[model samples]
Target: MSVRIGFIGVGGIAQSHLSGLLTLPEAEIVALCDISRQQVEKAVERFNKEAVGKEPAGRKLEAAIYDDYRQMLRREKLEAVFICLPPFVHGEVEEAVIEASLPFLVEKPVALSLSLAGKILDGVLKKELITTVGYQLRCGSFMDKARAALAGKTVAAIVANRFGRTPGVSWYHRQDKSGGQLVEQATHQVDMLRYLVGEVDTVYAAAATRINNKDNPEYDIFDSNCMTMTFACGAVGNFGNGTMAHVGVPPGLNGVHIFGDNVQVTIGGNLRIATPDGVTEEPLDKDMMVRQDSAFLKAVAENDPTLIRSDYLSGVRTLAVTLAGEKSARTGQPVKVADLLAAEAPAAL
Candidate 1:
């Protein structure tokens, strides 16, 4: 039997997963929910258009649509769910999903704050639900090569940067809704740092909202931000990001550069490594999302949580690091990731 699936949000990220699911024969999305009725209709139309000429040509593409996720969850019999909502719209929906006892795949920056993310993580663990986070960089071939190149080398310092234009979505610019660029956009790089380096111990950040989009008052997120991190392994990381530049323009580089004793690895447009002998470079494959989606579906289908690369707990840690960075930026003091996570644990949860 095919794994019945439901989507809690129909947004751009949801399209990526929807496109991925179209390629998988074992998964069928039967229910969709979003606050916008137009978005829900558009999602249904897009899915049907893509599914029409596929192998399952006769399969029904029409799905029940609801403006509220709770109604969808209560009415649909789903084996798995995809929580694709914004960072601010997290807590209650996740609790409801856990209550339903269905495996779920959530997009990253799990919540706006570490306390809320920790609360969600506690529920996920208590219920032992299968979960996957949308940190696709962990599933990339570039990461695999980078890991192999740094196997025996002692990484000393890491540098990560992201230069991009503001998101088209208005909510992304609001720090309360999207958790700023560090927590929302550059999270992939932070998670990549944790995945490639080690867990972050402390974060010190400096940020400013210099470039004001006078037209939009909701644009309160920082335009330029610099963060310094100390890893548990004693490695230091210099990570910074800016929303003042275009994403694909010149001087806009986004990726991690790892430096070891006598070796250096750069992962951006491509994966490159330099040693005493020579430099090796390979174009990075662009199928990480496909691999990510495949893994989550397989985990849900086979009842194997091990298939997922970045699960809920790991995502929560990444979220904590970003939240700490945000706090550091606001307070002008270094914040410890461990302390943030420890303070978030509720006695009952």
Candidate 2:
């Protein structure tokens, strides 16, 4: 029997997951919901065309569309759900999903508000639902090698940077909406830093709006961010990102590097490791997002939660770490992640 799925948001990120789910024979996307009904319809048309010859013979895509997610949740007999909403619009959808006792996969930087995220995490834990986050990089084959390379070795520091053009999406330019590049885009690195090194204890950051805002007057998010972090295990990290590049000009440099006891790891388009003994390189064999989708579907089918790497709590922690940096940048003082997570109380859900 195929695992039935419903999507709560049908935006660009949702389509990324949709592309992966369309390849699986056991996955069936039964419903899609978004504020714009037409957006859902268009996504259906796009993916259905891609599903040609992939589905069972003569099985037409009849996925229902909706502008209201609550109605879709009540009406559909879904086995699982994918909440692919933006940073600012996550809490309510997740609460409803948990209330319905359905397993779900939510995209990362889970929510802009830490209190709400913590509340959702608490509810999820109470229900013991199988949940996964969209940090697909963790599903990469190259990541396996990176983890293996660090076995028994301590990671001392992680240094990473990302330079790119402003995303075409309008919400990304608003700090209140997207929380700048650190919270929105470079969050994958923050999550990976935690996965590989350790939990960040403190964050100090500085940022400026150099260029993007000048051209796009309404742009409120900073174009550049530089951050420093101290980890629970005494490891450290320096990460920076900027959104000032031209559309056609490539940043020419992006990725993370880890330094440790006799080990150096580089993760970019591929994975590279150097030790006193030798150097190893691993290239990804498939799309990590697709792999993540496959793993989540399997977890749902078999009721096995261990198959997922980044669970809901992990996503919440990552959001806290990134938001701590944002707060530090604004205040010019180091922000402890624990302090940030503790200051917020769960709002009425």
Estimate, for each residue in 1-349, the C-alpha lDDT of model 1 and write its tens digit: 4789999988999978877776767778888889998988976776776667565633445678889888999999999999999888999999999999999999987888777888888888888899999999899888888888888779899998998888887588888889899999899999998888879999999999876566666689988899999999889989989898743646525778999978899988888899999999999888788789888888888889999889999998888888888899999999998888888843212
Q: Write the per-residue lDDT of candidate 2 for residues 15-93, one digit (tens) a residue.
A: 8777777667788989988998988787777767766876653244578888999999999999999999888888889
Q: Count the backbone clashes (under 3 Å) in each candidate.
A: 0, 0
- For candidate 1, give the lDDT of residue 110: 86
Q: Candidates' TM-scores?
A: 0.94, 0.94
Whole-model Cα lDDT per candidate? 0.86, 0.86
**Runs with alpha carbons beyond 4 Å of true place in candidate 1:** 50-60, 246-252, 346-349
C-alpha lDDT of candidate 2 relative to the true structure: 0.86
